[model samples]
Target: MTETPNLKIPHGGYVVVGDGRRALVLRNEGHALHLALRVQHVFEAPPNPPTREQGTDRPPRVRQGEHRSAIEQTDWHTIAEERFADEVAAALDRIADAIPALIVVAPPRTLASLRQALSERLKRVVIAEIDKDLTKLSIEEIGRRLTDG
Candidate 1:
């Protein structure tokens, strides 16, 4: 990893940290990093669907008498993560010009979703990607992680 100059913000760059449920956008000011944005969007899926009282309802068989089960469906949690990633991508796109460099910190799953959601334009400015869930870390800890090689 190329050592950053005291981990200062590259002009108007940003560092983003998130998981499936929450995200924190930060920017470096002088020698400190501060919260530049905060998204508290949460996806609360019901414990059970109206049709089923346990887990998600499985799709009905294609044929009434067919022995094969319906194709497995995507989980609500996965869908929510994708949607959150899209939201993050859109937010980054909106501030593309202001942020020339970006450091993304998220879990492996969320990182994958974010990678898929990012547009080509936004991809160009991504400087580093840390595959770890840092959403719960304090600001000082986050700064240390960003600067630590």
Candidate 2:
């Protein structure tokens, strides 16, 4: 009879945990995980302008009594988050070949953004994805959570 391979065993690979604000890159070392890098999004926080800026100039009114309106102001927070995701994706792309596998952990929205930002090649290496913000967790706690879950 053929034996089935054990699926519960964790493979050596990279573990990435983050939100839009910060990220942690960890690699499996023997049976333990070690931090390889930390990435922080300096622009994740919204800028503090001296005062609220005025909206874009209104569209010129037509002579026929109707007028077009400008689009709503940009959502800077969402933009920053997406930019952060792109940064993470680029970082992953650079190291994808070095890692045997990959596990991603992030908040739901950030995870979606990161998934969208990753290249198709990088996407193939992802072994698991946990939708939780673990960027703030300690290395030990993160390791435990990864193993327990």
Candidate 3:
């Protein structure tokens, strides 16, 4: 975590806490002053190893004229993370109709991916975006952080 923003999650508001591998959606059950979050949905992606482990063959060779050039190896881990972002966006779209407002919390890189995956209507529902990885924190601890931090 870098900087903690002042946040007040109103009742019926939703918070999407995620990173590259996990996305946890929580709904606020209490008022703005007292935040009590209840887990509504969770998306946990399968473990994605590094490119070296996931890739079987070496970099592909491109033939140009008489010389051969090796293309850069693909990053499987980054691809998996991007796909995970799409899944999270779909989940948020599914629950958007029920939420009054939304707050998104993710690391800087994941946040950009999520922002791109989310729909226009769903984007409008987002009231705050906190660039931090709060997925590992307990629900109680998250609530405390939102209210106190």
Leading candidate by lDDT? 3
Q: Estimate the Cα RMSD of every predicted model relative to the unseen true structure.
A: 5.0, 6.7, 2.4
Q: Rank the candidates by lDDT, best first.
A: 3, 1, 2
User: What are the Cα lDDT values of the candidates?
Assistant: 0.68, 0.67, 0.86
- The C-alpha stretches of model 2 lying farther than 4 A from their native spots are 1-11, 32-70
lDDT of 1 at 120: 84
Writing each residue's lDDT as its tens digit, candidate 1 over 1-149 gives 23354454454567878886777877654333433333323333233333333345665556556565686655666776788889888887887777777777788899889888988887887887878787788876777666664
Tens digit of per-residue lDDT, candidate 3, span 20-119: 9999999999988888899998999997776898785788899999999999888887789899999999878886788788888899989889989998
TM-score ranking, high to low: 3, 1, 2
Better of 1 and 3 by lDDT: 3
**Model 2 whole-model lDDT (C-alpha atoms):** 0.67
Q: Which stretches of candidate 3 lie over 4 Å from their true place?
A: 1-4, 65-68
| Candidate 1 weakest ten by summed lDDT | 36-45
lDDT of 3: 0.86
